[model samples]
Target: MDSLSARSSPPPAATSPFSNPKPVELLKKVIFAWVQETGLPASICVRVHGKSFDLHRSPLISRSGYFKKALRASNAVELHQEFPGGPEAFEMAALFAYGSRLPLDPFNVAALRCAAELLEMTEDHGSGNLCEAADLYLNQVVLQSWDDTLIVLQTCHTLLPMAEELLIVSRCVESLAFMACMEILDPEQKRGRPVLPLRTFSDRPWDPEAVKELAGHDLWIKDLIALPFNFFARIIRSLRRQGMKEKYVSPVVVFYANKWVLSKKTHKFWEQEDGADHAANTNDKVSAILQAIVELLPIRSQDPDRNAEIVPVTFYFALLSMALSLNLSDGIRVNLQHCVACLLHLARVDDFLLPENRVLEDVSFSRELKTMEEIVTIRVAFKSAENAEVVAKLWDLYLCRVAGDPKLGTDRFMQLIHTVPVADRETHDHLYKAINAYLSAHPRLCNEDKARLCSSISCQKLSQEACIQAVLDELMPLRLIIQALFVQQLHTQRALKDCSESFRYMQCGVFSGSIPSSTCQLPKSQSPYDPEETTPVPLEDHLVQRSEHSEVEYESTRFRMQALEQELASLKHSLRRRNPFGQVSDCIGSLRWSSQRKYTNRMLKVFRRMSMLGKSKSKIKQRASASGSLACRSKSLNEMYDC
Candidate 1:
């Protein structure tokens, strides 16, 4: 009975050896206190950047794989391991290994992450992964400032191996891309400028004052140009995908792409085995890089207006440089060469001032060609050899022989004329001779057209007025009336410059249906005591009382002003509506032609001509003629008006 009672008592609650174990926080405190305050014996020594840290061997080996292998490999009193991140980074890493919270601040985070990667300190022991902790600090702290993040990313690119190990490069790119996307979708951001506003990562609304402060510092585009090629490519591609326009992005892309190509081509003399091999290697590399970059770049829109807008003059020069140097694939080379020619064409259209333009500052570009023939050759190549012959014929008939209407090729022609410096005697002589040869080949061209074309092509010794006169004299069977009209219009234009204010007033009167009486008259209150001074009269209420002679003079002036305006309007209309021929076509038709399409099959050809003429004459006002056949009369007054 006593044994059963004793068994039921559970052997007096046997003492548990594991009872009252130290709390984790208290235990860590005690260990740290012992390490910091007490003279505790440390079994290992870690040397970093010539500095030694005396640490416990057990903790070092348990927490770091590096220490474990390093210590096991040697039984010496101290274990010295190589850490690349210097002493400070090693100290931060060591603290992390000691079960202490990491000092993952912005200033030290990048260094610490690099050290962790170098030391293989990536284990998770409830404290956290040091690499991840550093990254979090990077994102939350360092990346809060755009400049800081950009600098870090650029640094990471330079330190390729360390960055890849820590994953800083990719994460930095991601952060920039996200910010770019935010800017793209932000409604308040300006349409063409992707200026990102400053804000915290907490997703707070951007402050107006902060934006104002940032305006002085809004130059991310310039910084973007300085990024490593691959990183720059990714950021630009990502930005474009979010909604940036191709025109805005294409110039920079081309610039950097050309720059990158040039950079890669910079080979050491010893690196190349032979010219052929070097060329082949360069060609292959260029093709690969261009293809990859092209895939990531923004595609130009189908809108011709947007495409036609002028890029920086440097774009053409850069592209031309690429064409002359890099042995790109046939498709890419042809396309790029065509772009170079097209840009030259566009530059001419924009009246690109070569002397003033920055692109001409490049010595390589300026020295590439010394002859006008070279410029013409580039243009001809742009049209392709097969098309060049026919294209020349088309231009001669429409642009030269007719009345000097500027066709699409006009800009390219003008660009060719001005690309050479006036001081370059040899080149200018070559250019002058080339122009004369061109003019002499096309004899049927009108005097005015010849005069205009020669005027556009600058000569070294010949004054512009003298050149025009020489070309005009050389033209065959000049129309005296047309020449007289051209001179008269020139004189009228000179006179109109002086009468600009009056012309403007007259224009306003025409639109308003009444001229303001005050426009031409002095106030009656000049004496400061006139009877009309107290009466505040509205402009519409005012009536003038003057002598008959003064009235007659005023009437004559008004009539003269009206006639001058009419003549100017007619001159402007003529200049604006001329076809490539500089002459209006013979068959002017109306909407009546479309309604009368059901006319007999005999008149189908006539109807088609009428339809074609209707489309051409859409903007011109139709006038009835009293004499001659339809074709003859159309050629007479209409051709005169069209030019």
Candidate 2:
């Protein structure tokens, strides 16, 4: 044969039924046409939905008819002979889609969901396309279905291609989409739901009614509800997984039953027992979140991006829900937000804040921090593929609440701060710039409009402790309080520590700024003496004779301390003992209530005293060190390297 002819001649073809001899026939027989003709499964979903909607007209076998049509049309049965998870899935999906919707027939939903899941493991060389179509249908109706929210969440025995797809898509969600859908869920719309500022995520100047109409849609309340679903799912899942259903279920159930106590609709019922009601609300909120994390997302090595973006999204919603449902403060909000930041870091696939992004280490703190530079350069509009505030919030919350516990007090105060690769100079510098700008402008977070102010600033976690301590530098007053409440609230039922590193909000309550004197609630109702600012107790030298005879001389102040400690010990004992009422008041009282106001004050006093002592010691040390020659300073500077 001629070389050209030999080259043109096709190589020995593989043994197959349709090795086309004609080019024209090959085009017609190609898989493209088959795919085009089969089309997407979206139509199948709409058709099934329509048929199912006609209650009296639709037959039980309508789904089978559609499945049969799909099978015949696509030759899916033949395809499944070589594909994966195909034919049986086609049948089960139809049933699940319809079953999940009809509230009266959950068994059908259960049957369909499980049956379809069996096809997942069939491994019958099912067509990826067919399986994908089936998965997409199920995920849209089932995973995101509000009607069968609990069922879909609790019965997470299998992972379909669609759920994986959803997870993938969720990793790239935009803030606009989150805000668009989330704002619609007014916790106030339903009693016991969270009542947060759904409109704006920013503390600067967000309008509570920015997208009021949009927030009121059914699309906003998804099956894996960001708030409602998460809270319940967290509680149920964790308890069930831990096999502690009976142990903690009753108290939580009672708290839930007293939902009436939470509803502002029945505010009068709790008016006299606000503290008790608040405590109950707080504990229930915790239980709800525990149920969600433990139950909703099964224990799987989730995609880093998905975990980074989606985990924190769910958590922020949980935090928001806890804040609204139970009214938390800035201290709690800081802690929760901090915890979120830690989880996000754990979930990140890449150092989102990279060396290129790190302006500080790149050049040292040359009049600017590195991380801040990146922030300034990074565009953070409502939309951006590169944007990840949900992730950032998670990290920020971590730094604030769990990272550095100053009370470990010494070297550890900077542990978390250092453990987290300090934000590069750019980011740090950028933060400084923002801070300076804010301070220069005398920036105010609250608005004159009552609802606007309430919506914009969450006072729940923005207590003096959170701010002055500088734990939550990114958090504002309102956001901080809400964050803190979630921590305090969630901890009562289930510790955030039990959650995986990717989900736990560890340093969530770290506050920024100084803990002002007014941070404590002054007892307006029972102040027997004026609040003391400075100075120590006066020694009555002239009363030496009286002290020699009167054992009751130190009565009042000593009595106050004993009374406070007794009250606190009793409260802790109650919490340890599990109060008969089952409220978490005991936990609250232990954390906040003390008889010796002076004793608590003294702890603050000790901090101040230590501050003075350290300053004096440092001054003396500095003077003594100065005794070194100026030439030594030059050598030390050379070793340090120039900034």
Candidate 3:
């Protein structure tokens, strides 16, 4: 136990004058030389003093058998609040050994454990001024015992939830400063001489049952906010060294980052009880983090592949930027905004280097995208009770009535529209378009999506059926716009008497409850073209609704058209075959006569039925019409006709 007593031999491999060896070897040498009969070296004594000093503060005996057992894999427990430091120190040594990628030398094995202990003390334990402490021992730390590092890392695993809080607070700078030391000074988790800060949040799909799972592993908020800067530094250094020259490697990295980015995109910064605390991140702190992300963004961006197979891969840097700087303090929101703006810029960098991809490109995504997007989604709306009220505000900017007028003010929509730069228009359009395209081209957002985007609905009773009722909610605005346009265009035409046949058709189609020809311009083509768009197209298909996932739109439109055409053809055939005269007049006359008396009777029956429908439409109308003149009669006549 004496500082001057040498107990163990230095393990196998020696540092070659040639290639770089591991840090654990050095650690072993330190331990072998330090526990000597003579006086300890200045550096060796200093390093041991720090790791051992905590022993005095903590009650655990340094030489306890329990502590020794923790050094081995036979027992590992870092998740609990009370993991022993001696065992924890052993875990660190093991991790450092693996990471340093050197042969295990028993003499420096203690050094590796010392490194792990240093990192845990700073990152998880608030052990000391982690950077200064780790830096003091960095010269003596081992780098070979990385597997051992995992053992140590496994002990610090519960840091995930704490990382979540740090992310939310937008204390990303502090988070980076916190982890930066861990990455470098620790010599275990740290690799490649990374000087910049780095925080990693990894949650694999599976975990030991009844133990811990990554599925629900919420990251420390600080880590989340610091993710942008930390991830960027980590990725740039780690990936650049790993050879981004590998064709798909960059893409994969991009994919993971994109998931985190989009997930943060949807997070409502204001949702937390302490949400306001993070408001500070809105300022310069966020800006600095954003600047870091921008500095690391990749240069050439393109997915030349047809499928856009790993499309999200392109978003890695952006995702990291997003994940970081997430914990925006009230002061940091500006910084977060600036960071977001930079991310948006990064996402849109290439603008256009190739023909736009229009097909429903499909790729199997890891949960990263879903996870980040969920964060983005949740943040966008439900971050606070206040956010819930403002969510429908999207209608103010995006929803349009009849492809022309937005129900929300035009100025408002235009304001929002202007916010999207021309360079990003295509990507933003492609994203939503691609989603709808995927859904429409493949399946609806779900199986019930069939019920969502059919583009055509069969009019059953045309009454208030749930589906029908929903349709009216959507189409009534459309109808209002159509009616407005009809009225506007009519001024240029003539009166009802002088209007052309086309005018009558338009009017009748609308009033008679027949689906109107798509105001979106119907195409003359009878057959589906393989080059057909996935989204609904106008007359010539110049990317009409490509912004809505061209694939899905195309599929929906194609299906609806096919169905409608078949029905129209059958009706025509029946008319022609039955009449022999190639006339609809005979059929029309018979139908008219059969319906005249019955239609009038049905009108009365409907009025009686409405009494049970919980409405007083008739009474209201009657009350108003009681004093009317020609208008009243005409109104009554129209109602009768509808019956």
Q: Which candidate comes out best when scored by TM-score?
A: 1
Which stretches of model 3 miss by more than 4 angstroms? 1-247, 251-308, 311-397, 400-410, 414-643
Report lDDT per candidate: 0.45, 0.31, 0.30
- When summed lDDT is taken over every stretch of 10 residues in candidate 3, the lowest stretch is 198-207
Write one digit per residue (lDDT tens) for candidate 3, span 578-640.
343444422122334444344324323332332222242222221121122322332443343
For model 2, the local distance difference test gives 0.31
- For model 2, residues 446-504, the per-residue Cα lDDT tens digits are 22221222232222333334322222232223223223333222221121112212111
Residue runs of model 2 more than 4 Å from their true location after superposition: 1-216, 219-282, 285-294, 297-301, 307-413, 422-643
Query: Order the candidates by lDDT, highest first — what do you get?
Result: 1, 2, 3
How many clashes does each candidate structure show, in the order listed? 0, 94, 106
lDDT tens digits, residues 65-180, model 1? Answer: 67667787663423234444456566666667666775444345566677777666665433466766776778777666555566567556435577776678777776676665
User: What order do candidates take by TM-score, descending?
Assistant: 1, 3, 2
Kindly indicate the candidate among 1 and 3 with the higher lDDT.
1
Deviation (Å) of 183 in candidate 2:
23
